[model samples]
Target: MHKVSVIIPVYNVEKYICECLESVMAQTLSTGIECILVDDRGNDASMEAARKCIAGYSGPIKFQLVVRAENGGLSAARNTGINNAKGEYVYFLDSDDIITPDCLNLLVERASEYPDAEIVCGDFQTFPQKDVHKLISLQGKNFPESSFDKSWIRSVFLSSFPVIAWNKLIRTDFIRRNNLYFREGILHEDDHWHAQAYRHVSGLAFVNKVTYLYRMRPGSITMSDGVEERRLENMTLIFSEMFAKEVEWDKPWSDWILKSVGSLRYIGNKANIKEKAEHCVSQLLPTVYKNQSAPFILRLLFKYYFHNGVIFSSRLFYKLYAIYWKYKG
Candidate 1:
């Protein structure tokens, strides 16, 4: 079996696809690696460029060009790639970005060292430009030293570790056994997938090496116009799903307190969405915070701020969470 399957979803990334593929082809640990390129039926020359790049390739790593029947979005494309992937571990590499020659090598090595790790996260650097992007994304970043449980989820909100698929190497069996597939028909699918996948991860390991190079492409979803409302809606959906699952946790407030405030911060004033969030929080608070043995000020924040028609900022949540983390019994 292949040690790693690099899944690259091809969809109108013709200009940068070749560079992305070359980075994989140049892998220092190319043996037992396969690259699966899922063509999501975009009306572009991306596949042609990928074909031309692979035509002359005499590398040990195998390549598969899997074509979809119709044009599906990024989430669907990644699902197809995961379905077709045959490696023990799978790494999603966006066609527009590139990875270091040792990307696979480092990830596989870390996974081997900690065989119980269902997810292994690697650090990254934004390429060519976007130094400011690096600062905002990397500041306060705290990586776990070894495989850990749900407590590690704290990093998602409190730290700079992001929720992007490209930087995470996921174990194939862990994903399938838990039925963790990307939610289809949505932008920012990674945000949804991040929460879903983490819900089942036994533990996550971190390899702090900079293996991936992230490129800030023009016309990306974040830069597109007329999508603010849609973005808010999708984030609300994702956060709500998380909140639902979190309420079932034995100690929901541990993560839920910070996460709930984080949710309100993003899904601000989206028509009647506040009611949905409030309802969820209302059901959770009496059962959770009243019985949850947490810090006094933290519990006070959630209990009052959630129901008193009051809203707060993520910075306040962070400030309080930082204190809670520093003095948790």
Candidate 2:
């Protein structure tokens, strides 16, 4: 069996797909890697580019292209790739992103060392196409190179480590056995799947190496403008499901909620979506204020805002703070 199955979801990334495929082709452990390309019926020439790259490829890595009949969004495409994966571990990769040559080798090596770890996470860097030289590494000082069992799940979740799916190599059988799948028809599907994995995985390991290079495309859903409403809706649904599952509102959960509120406030202020912002603050502020996991200063700020009926003022304060920091820097 293949050591790792890299699942690349191809949509409208025609311009960047070739580089992504080439990155996979350049993996150090080519013989034990399988690259699964899922074409989600995009109208662009992304599939054509993928086919061309695969056809011209002379690599030892096995490749499979699965073309869906209908366009089912990112979550569905990921599920399709997971369903067809044949490797022991599955790693998600976006069509616009590229991985280092040793990405798979590092992950597989770490997994081999920790045979009981069902999930292994590595660090990553984010870069824009134009500013590729100015890549920003996301390695955290808090995340030591170590293996963690189920007891450390909360600490893992609360650490500076990112919750993104692409940074982790997950055991295929673990995911299937736990019935962990991305939520279909949602934009922020990673949030749910990552939460579930953390909850159910027997153990997880961290590899302190930069393996993945996440490309910050301008038109991507997370970066694009005018998608605030969709983002807010999806995040709300995700949080609601999480709360329903009785996930403790500990420090990590509180931190996530606060960040979510901050994002909603920023988007609302930018787009003048007052009603949505007000509603979200009203629903979330009480829980955020009550949770003791957040920093004392943040909790105090929330308390002041809640008592003073100036919840919206935090947005202005954040903007001014940003400007101050920019000038200071």
Candidate 3:
């Protein structure tokens, strides 16, 4: 079997697709890898561009291209690739992001050292963006080191990192055995999947060296107007799904959802979606109460907003605080 199946879900990323593919082709690791490029019905010349880049490729790895008939979203594209993967391990690569030459090599080495590991992750740097730089402190630049657990992930997820498919390599047998696939038609599908995946993980590997480059484009969904509402709705859905599962009730996970809603409220009001912001809070507060052991600070924030009708004020505070930070930075 192939060692790794690098799945790249292609959309309309004509600008960066070539560079992204090249980075994979240049990987120093000569392991059995399958580069499966799934084209999700793009209008642009992205397919043509991808074809040109792959024509001269003569690496040890096998390469294949797939073109889907319908324009399913990112989750569907990824699921398609995963369903067809012929490797012992899988790594999902965003069409627009680029990986370092040694990323696969490092991850494979780490996973080999810990053969029982279901997942292995490495550090990644955001390709120089103005506001993105402000969000991350220089002191926090070191790679993350932690024992993998639901609570550990819940705490780390609070910092608003992109804990999506890109930075990790997953064991294919575990995924297939568990029938784990991205939740179709959900905006933040990764959040939901990771919660469950983290629970089932018998072993995990964290490499504090090497890196991937996540390019920030202005038109990305995170930078769009509709994202605020979608995120709020998505978190509500995720929290409900988590509770319904057979796992133990997770207080930290509940707290994380509240924080997500709180952050959404802050961004929604700034985006002038006050009514929608209130709607999200209403859906989220009941779940917050289920966590009887929640910390006082979070409970207080929830009580003040829900009981005192302080959501509007809460929203305003975030807006002003963001403006101040923008000016100060």
Candidate 4:
């Protein structure tokens, strides 16, 4: 067994797979790391590029490739990687992204320090292809370098540290014991799995150093223009499932809703999926309003909408609020 299993889900990332794999090959703690590359039946040369890189790689880490029988999407590809991983900790890496030379070393060091932590997170930086050499810190002021238990899990959820899967090094046993798996065939699968995992984590740790480099490339699923409807539907489904759970109310709930409203408005305006976005807002408003932990302004807005139903419809209000946010930013 290895110390960490870096799972790379390969789709149509032929242009960037070599760089991603090379970063894996250049890990400081290369001896005890296993790189599992899962091919999701992509039509491009991604698999070929991976094979060439792995073939020429002289690193001490173990490398394995799993080819899917058919195209099962990102969730399925990641699930396959998780199922095949033989490491104590699992780290998901996008094929288009790269990690620092000490990424694995830093995460493993933090894990050693916090032996009870089920999840260890490191900061990340995002860059476009042209500016790949530049690094910008995504760490926020509220993110502290400390170890937290389940009691502080909600705070972790509400922190500036992203809820993204790639930024964290998760214990394999914790994920297996909790039966945590990504929802297959969905666009926003990470949100669902992370939401559940956050609730059950026994301990969490943070590494203040930036380790991962997220590439903001065009035509990626999150940045694509044509997938707005599917994205909106997936967002709604995830939030519905999350809100229906009998979890304690907290400020994070309200903050997340408020933050999501901006995305809803963007989807409505860009994708012409206003009806679906409005439906989700209608379903979530009551829950958002009921959470005392939420900001007073958000609750007040919901109350105003409730009392004056005709004057400020959910859709209209979201549109106006999004405008305010745009200008504020």
Candidate 5:
């Protein structure tokens, strides 16, 4: 079986897709790699470019293009890739991003050393399109000091690692057993997926050096106009359903969940969330731990919203909460 399956979702990234695919083809590991390109039926020649890339490639790696009947968005394409990956480990690579030639080589090496690690994350940096090639070709395939001292490894606090899906090599069985599928129809899907996926990790590690190069596109989703409105809307939905999906609450990592739940200090006014959605958030609060270990303000808000709103306590908490927000936010 292949050691790693690199999943790249193709859309209207014709201009950058070639560099992305070429980097995967140039992996220093050479063998035991399969690149799965999911064609999401974009109105462009990205697939045409992919076909040419596969045809011209004279390497040991196997390339497969899965064509979807319709464009189901990034999450859907990612789900399809996860469903079809036939490797021990799977790595998500955005079509607009490029990885160093030794990226997979080094990640596979680290995974081999730490067989129990479910998710091995490699460092990544954002680069302008003009500098992508230079970034990919930068020297230093190995990091002796970073690897030796292990200063690069960090404990995931509430899944705090970047939240981006790319540049992480995840064990296939780990993802499958935990049902870590990306939710479709959500804008910041990573926010929800990252939180869920990290909480289940028995062992997690990181390769500190930058292995992935993210292209800084002008009209990227995060920088697009009217994005803040969409972000707030999706964040509302994320906080609403994140805990209702029945995560195991009695495990050793339960503290993580407690911290996550205790941090919901939103009183329906922060993001101008609709009254109905705010009610949904309030409903979920009671089911959280009786003594939540989440962030301080979220705990305060929990009392303010869940309790009967005693006038004196409410006023006092509001004053403190207001002060906290004024300085912290």
Candidate 6:
């Protein structure tokens, strides 16, 4: 079996597939790595583009193109790749992103160092089309210097959102053993899957340098306006799972709720979400209260309205909130 399987879920990224494929093929490591490309029912000549992209590369790498008949969302595409992965370690890369030549080498090195660790993560750089690149670090507390524990992981996860799966190199067998997979149909599936994965993980390792380069497009889903609602719904789904299984409550749980409240406020600013946003935010508020993270003062802000009162008084609540903020400012 290959040492690492690099899975790329392709949709309509015909413009950037070439560079993405080249980056994988150009890995500095001589270690055996298989590249699995899943085409999720794209009409943008993605199939032909993929074939041409990997045509001339001859290395220890093996490549396969999986074309699904129907158009599944990103989660399903990734799950399909996960199911077909035939390597000891599984690494996920988006079709539009590029990796450094040492990306595979670094992951393999980290995994070898922490042989017992199920997941190994490295830092990545995000480059917007017209703006300078920024490094998005996932190495908050689980890096080479620190020892891993539940609390450390909880803090590390709370430091930022785990939307980019490219920084992680996960063990395939461990995933199968734990029955871990992405949540299909969720906009931010990574948050839920990674949250659950970190719970059972024995250890985590990180590389200091940038290994992956994420090219930010103007209209990417990460930059979309509709993401806030979907993200809130996904977080609600995740917290429900955590509570259902009786996972131990901790400060990070409260922190996550705080982050969700900020997200609700953000969604409240969108004109398109004016109609249903309040109900959605109301649904999310109960979970936030269940965590009891909000300060007493913040909780009092919603005191006039009962726990579920926002569901009925959503429009008025939003209007009053707007007027209050407008004058308060």
Clashing pairs in 1: none
**On a 0 to 1 TM-score scale, where does candidate 2 land against the true structure?**
0.81
Q: Between prediction 4 and prediction 6, which has the larger lDDT?
A: 4
Model 3 residue 316 distance off true place after TM-score fit, in angstroms: 15
Off by over 4 Å in 2: 128-138, 149-151, 247-251, 254-263, 281-309, 313-329
For candidate 2, what is the lDDT? Answer: 0.74
RMSD of each predicted structure: 7.0, 7.5, 7.4, 6.4, 7.7, 6.3
For model 4 the local lDDT of residue 293 reads: 38
Worst 10 residues of 6 by lDDT: 288-297
Worst 10 residues of 2 by lDDT: 131-140
lDDT of 2 by residue, 1-329 (tens): 98888999899999999999999998888577888999899889999989999999887888999988899988889889999999999999999999999988888888898878887888777775533222122443555455464446665563444667896889999889989888999887877777666566667677777898888877887889878887777776676566446566566665565566666666666678866765655554444333333354355345445643654766644643343344332
Model 1 has an lDDT value of 0.72
Model 4: how far residue 4 lies from native, Å: 0.3
Counting clashing residue pairs in each candidate, in order, gives 0, 0, 0, 0, 1, 0
Error of 5 at 299 (Å): 3.7
Q: How does residue 186 of candidate 2 score in lDDT?
A: 88
- Per-candidate Cα lDDT values, in order, are 0.72, 0.74, 0.72, 0.77, 0.70, 0.71
For candidate 5, write residues 1-329 as lDDT tens digits: 99999999999988888899999988899889999999999998999988887889889999999998899999999999999899999999999889999899888888888788787778777786434222222234342322322223224324244567788898999989999999998888887887677556666666767799888887677667656556655765775576555655433234444444333333233344434334443455444423233464475465554654432234544554555554455
Model 1 scores worst on lDDT over the 10 consecutive residues at: 282-291
Error of 1 at 46 (Å): 0.8
Worst 10 residues of 5 by lDDT: 145-154
Task: Candidate 3: give the clashing pairs.
Answer: none
Candidate structures ordered by TM-score, highest first: 4, 2, 3, 6, 1, 5
Residue-level lDDT for 40 in candidate 1: 92
- For model 1, how does the per-residue alpha-carbon lDDT over 166-285 read when each residue is reduced to its tens digit? 867789998788888899877778777766665566677778778889888666666576665566657656655565564434343355445654555445554445544444433344
- List candidate 1 stretches off by more than 4 Å: 132-144, 149-161, 250-329
- Model 3 TM-score, 2 decimals: 0.81
What local lDDT does model 3 show for residue 132?
A: 37
Q: Output the number of the TM-score-best candidate.
A: 4
Error of 1 at 60 (Å): 0.6
